[model samples]
Target: MNRLRFAPIPAGLPATVPFTGPETLERRSGAPFRARLGANENGFGPSPRAIRAMADAAAGVWKYGDPDNHDLRHALATHHGIAPENIMLGEGIDGLLGLLVRLTVSPGDRVVTSDGAYPTFNYHVAGFGGQLVKVPYRDDAEDPDALIRAADEVGARLVYLANPDNPMGSWHPGHRIRAMLDNLPEPGLLVLDEAYAEFAPDDAIPRIDPNDDRAIRFRTFSKAYGMAGARIGYAIGPAELIAGFDRIRNHFGINRIAQAGALAALQDQDWLNHIRAEVAAARARIAEIADENGLTALPSATNFVAIDCRRDGAFARALLDALAVRGIFARMPGVAPMDRCIRVSCGPAEELDAFAGALPAALRAIL
Candidate 1:
């Protein structure tokens, strides 16, 4: 009789997940959250066309998804004005990060990222036994130069940066990002997570050049397109580098329904623009709510806003717990300094109203 055993890394690591879903939390609390905003999901929902397309694809669930992701890949290539060879579809940006780590990061290889940039990327690095060298955030944003410097200093195999970063919702302008791409240490690839790119200003988005070897940009339908459940995203970069993903990528990982939804969502530029406008208004409202309570809301280029709690991490955590108790699902950064802010996702006016009604009471309870 033999008990189950795993590889050395899995055998030694604790059972920890990057995120605990709202459903699980609701189950424990005995009630669903009033405003589900913690996950940074697009609450306005996907395009009606996308929803219909997904429904249409539902009948084909019995069949395997196109392993090549051919049609969708060509669609994204057209959307970005790049060649299809430069694009590779994956389960999501999260999956792409995992695949990138697997492709480039041998155990004990150095990886660089901002201290609180994106925990899931860090999660991937850890799972793959890569040594992470974290640089601190500069003014609540991912410091591009600092990340590049760290990568060069450590001779890193990978450097991760999320433009208009998560948790903090801060962003750097395009020129600076282009500089980072140009100056990124050789032999070390840049993993640019643009999950929230649709919400950003024109100046905040860097140009996508398929021939650029310095970075591979990952974009998803989860945020602005309101398809978080779709689990579809695409990566654009040098054709050869893009092809490397074939070595280890899950051939049929992307589902048929998700593929259809993402393709429809991409073609619906009108819907994407509408979402951008809605997100912008919601960001302003979140900032306004923070101001009404005498807290400061940082400028955001993403679908969420980060309101400064005006105190330490302990207070922020207390405030977050209070929000949870009030059935509001806001989240916060998990580290020092940056942890003094709470992140609220952009949602419908009604959900934002629920948040506004809960904010004062939650703050007072924590106080």
Candidate 2:
């Protein structure tokens, strides 16, 4: 047998996964997780209208989705008060991010991000042969000033920022972000990932111009709309930048059902508000749980809460492992300091109850 040739870039890259899904863990343990709180999924579920839309669209699976994503984009435009031309739909924020990297990053081009930020963005940058320059998080939040300085120093083509951040679940005010954008080095594009925007405080999101060429914002149905399984998301930016995605994106990657479901989801703001209130209550409950367990819960602007174990990363990892052993799945930041906390997503009462019941025993086993 003859071996196939590999590209030098890909050959040099290590094979790695950004996340180990609960299903994989379930398979490994030979048991299902009693509480699926590891992933930041909206376990409260989607709007009834969205469910019906998906079910209705199912019969049309024989046909490919609109390559242009016309209806969904137009709907989203109306929802955000932006022109349809400013929107570009993709499989998810993950897919759109890859396209953005492809569109901007050349081999060895620099990209800037927080060291403990979203790994998926880093994965995409690596996949595209971009040199990633990381800055440590400041006070458990993404430091805009530090990020801008790093990007300027490294002459970065892109700088990634996640508002209402994952893992640690900390965030900065919108005015701070606006200041960062104003000072960003010329030619460096800001990739503002607002995947959890629906869960954030109103003041947390900056009022950047949708047509701003200096930045592009990524949003997803996965978080608030409970459409993670649909793999539907979109990017909003200047019309010119948005059009660039058409060159490299999978034209028909978004399925018809997902498109239909997303449209319906956008039209149902009442459901989104309901989910917000429920998530707020759940966050409070999670804080109470952490307090009862002798831990501190970091203030979160997202669907998840990061509980500080008053120990080191090792202790948090042990606690997470123990929780898994107890059939409760949770996750922690991959790096130090931040890893002193385990991240838990908001869900319905029963799931939280499962997590609550498992916490004490896990703590005893670990401590």
Candidate 3:
């Protein structure tokens, strides 16, 4: 008789997850946070049209989603001025990253990313048994030269970079990215994450050839559309590269209701513009609050503001803990230099008021 064996999972499994959601913070604290300002999510919520569409599709929730993501893909294609064949919808950028890794990376392959950049990409690479070579950020932005050098040095199969980066919120102009695109090596995929492109300034998003196979750009309804919970994101690239995703992706992973909502949301361009204005105002207010507290808030093209803590990671972490205890959910950077700051997401006026009210006490408690 064979006894139940307790062998462990493979050692290649990542020791840590890419990032923790704000729900985990609430669970750990054993209390609901008053101001949910972490996670860089748009607290403004999704378009009213999207909500109505989701509500209308509620009865169909039991049905499986379209495997081809047909309606949504066509709508996205129209939105991006590309053919449907050039677009591939995924559960979210997270799920897409996993599938991309599976499609391109083999065990022991090399991947390149910016040091202290998005952790989710690293998480996917590690899960696929790929070695990650990280390049340090230059002036708080992903350095194109350094990334190209690292990719060349390691003979990387893929390189990941988030324009208008997380934590730092700095971005390179679109023209700069276009110039660097020509330098990228062959047989290597550039995973350009443009999750925050809507928030970035004009000329910050490059216009690449829709048929460009050397790079694939990722966009999500999660950020500016304020539908992070909906988990809808799409990748735009060469039809062949985009088509390759179907071989390994969970075809029905994007839910029926989510697809309906995303379709409506895409059609509501006025609402998106309104939210963009709201986000800009919130960013200004956050910078004001930071200045009032004698802290320097970094200029941001993303929804959140990163406030330099004036000390080290220890101080930034202590401030984060204090803010959390004071019912304000905030997060800090995970590495040195950059880690000396705390990140706070833009929210409604009341939530910002809560953060402003808690600032002094939290600082005192931490210091």
Instruction: Please name the candidate that would achieve the greatest lDDT relative to the true structure.
Output: 2
Clashing pairs in 1: none
- For candidate 3, lDDT tens digit of each residue in 1-367? 2465433334547467666777888899899889999988889888999999999999989999999989989989888889999999998898888889989999889999988998888888888788899999887778989998888888889989899898798899988788668878866778999999999997899999879878899999899998998999999989998989988888778989999999999999899898899999999999999999999999899999999878999999999889988899988888888998999999999999999999989998877
TM-score preference between candidates 1 and 2, better one:
2
- What is candidate 1's lDDT per residue for 225-249, written digit by digit as tens? 9999989888888999889999999
Best by the TM-score measure: 2
lDDT, model 2: 0.93
Of candidate 2, the 10-residue stretch with the lowest lDDT total is: 1-10
Better of 1 and 2 by lDDT: 2
Task: Give candidate 3's root-mean-square deviation (CA, Å).
Answer: 1.8
The lowest-lDDT stretch of 10 consecutive residues in candidate 1 is: 1-10
Ranking by TM-score: 2, 1, 3
Which residue runs does candidate 2 get wrong by more than 4 Å? 1-3
lDDT of 3 at 99: 89
Per-residue lDDT of model 2, residues 150-171, tens digit only? 9999999999999989878888
Cα displacement (angstroms), candidate 1, residue 222, comes to 0.5
